[model samples]
Target: MVDNRYTILVSNEQFRFTRDQLESDPGNYFATYFFGEFAEASQGAKELVVEKDVHLFRLIQAHLRGYDIFPLPDAAIPPYMTKEVAIKNLHRDAQFYCLGKLEEKIKELELMSPNGRTGVRRDSPSAKRYKFGDETWSGLEWMFQDLNNDGYQLMLGKLKNLDMAIPSEQPLIPGFSLTFCWAKEHRYYVLLASDD
Candidate 1:
């Protein structure tokens, strides 16, 4: 009997996907790569060698097998104790794989400040937690622009202890303190006074 299972060799390790399973997501690159008009198909190859991070590839495999959202790193993974790097990497991978749903889900995750909770955003409105990094500043730039147009709310509420005083650190965007700050984690100062 002919085995309908196909092999995906990642770093010399093996993973399997059935023809039926792959055909289901014909739009995905894996399916196209394995089954499209190519040398592998003509040669009747049953396995395709893949070159990618094994952990990430496993996540992609799980996604193809119907995993909606991959979990962020739970513990301190070097250079990424924060959830930022993990999600960003996954989002990059999702885009490469053309997985729209996974990419969108990653984007919908909360933009947590250093002093904020990193729950799924449905858990709590996190304004204070710990470890404000470049990620948080990047997030704040556009997320609370309406409320922190003058950097008042951002200073008083979110970054109170960080010492991000207005004007000195605030952008000269007139009415908007528009800037992507690189200062977080280390001590800094910031506060805002409203025009009202």
Candidate 2:
């Protein structure tokens, strides 16, 4: 059984769709395109492309721009596959992509200003906005309390968002991974994993 001890604070289906598209298509494309372009080029050409590589950057920009009209080249293209290159590219993409979501999360956290207040009118637009309703807050509160007890600085960290904003295969922190998602339908959903 999957470990359910960790909670899902929020789940953004669009975010998930974006991640899936990246992993399923663009991610593979860039991995192959770059490696192939490198391998097929002469040593001098390889250095030139390395110094001025545009394919991977373009693909990343395409995804970042959130445009889907431009069809990704079919995978029928032979696998110019290089595991090391693919892995490295995947890591870079993962970090950059997660950081973008991290920014969004930061914005949400910023919305939660003066977090320690209680019954502070509860009329402000931000208070009207609760992440995943109360359940999400419960789980987050648990984690925050635990982390605080363990000496993690609460002042240094806020519930910007959850790991559910990122892909299941990618982890921002070591050991434990958790994702939080919030969408129009489901106010909040979370997925957590502990390689325990």
Candidate 3:
């Protein structure tokens, strides 16, 4: 059976389209994804906007704690948490829990974890070219710009394919990782690639 636990984490705002709408027009199945920060919105903390699979609502709630405008899936805590808190936590969890390794994908397109952080495989050469965030982006970029520009949300699959393969034994810097997401299969899937 589908895990009902996933349903509890999502807010009503996420349900942009009805089940019938998805059946008639799959492309219209889009929703506003709110990536919250750990502090006040005016501070460095800000929500990363993106279009993602509806299933991610549960995964997001799984990591959340305390009160929030959006209640946590398993949390009994009240809605005291701000968007900032949610954003910070999500960033932390996404870096760890989201994607598979780069070397694995090169071997086969199937999703698989690598030996190192995210998708960086151990013992791989340091010659691979990589980018910290969006390789196609530059300047003071907003975290959620892609979400607004593109009608669809970013999915984990895109991250898996973005070649975020970094060298092994290196710590993933805060605010940066060789990860990406893709919007497909009605969900998001992150992948490990390096920008080294």
TM-score of every candidate relative to the true structure: 0.48, 0.22, 0.17
* Lowest-sum lDDT 10-residue window in model 3: 145-154
Q: Compare the candidates by TM-score and give the number of the best one.
A: 1
Candidate no. 1 TM-score: 0.48
lDDT of each: 0.52, 0.33, 0.30
Which ranges of candidate 1 are over 4 A from the true structure?
73-82, 110-196
Model 2's number of clashes is: 8
Model 1 — which ten-residue stretch has the worst lDDT? Answer: 142-151
lDDT tens digits, residues 70-111, model 1? 345554233432466666676787788777666656554432
**Candidate 3: C-alpha lDDT:** 0.30
**Distance (Å) between predicted and true CA of 24, model 3?**
7.2
lDDT of 3 by residue, 1-196 (tens): 7321211123333333223322221121111111123333235321233443333444333223211323224353224545435434444434443322212222221112122123433455642322222222222332221111111122343344544333232334434343554333333223334344
Q: Residue 68 of model 3: what lDDT?
A: 31
* lDDT (Cα, 0-100) at 65 in candidate 1: 77
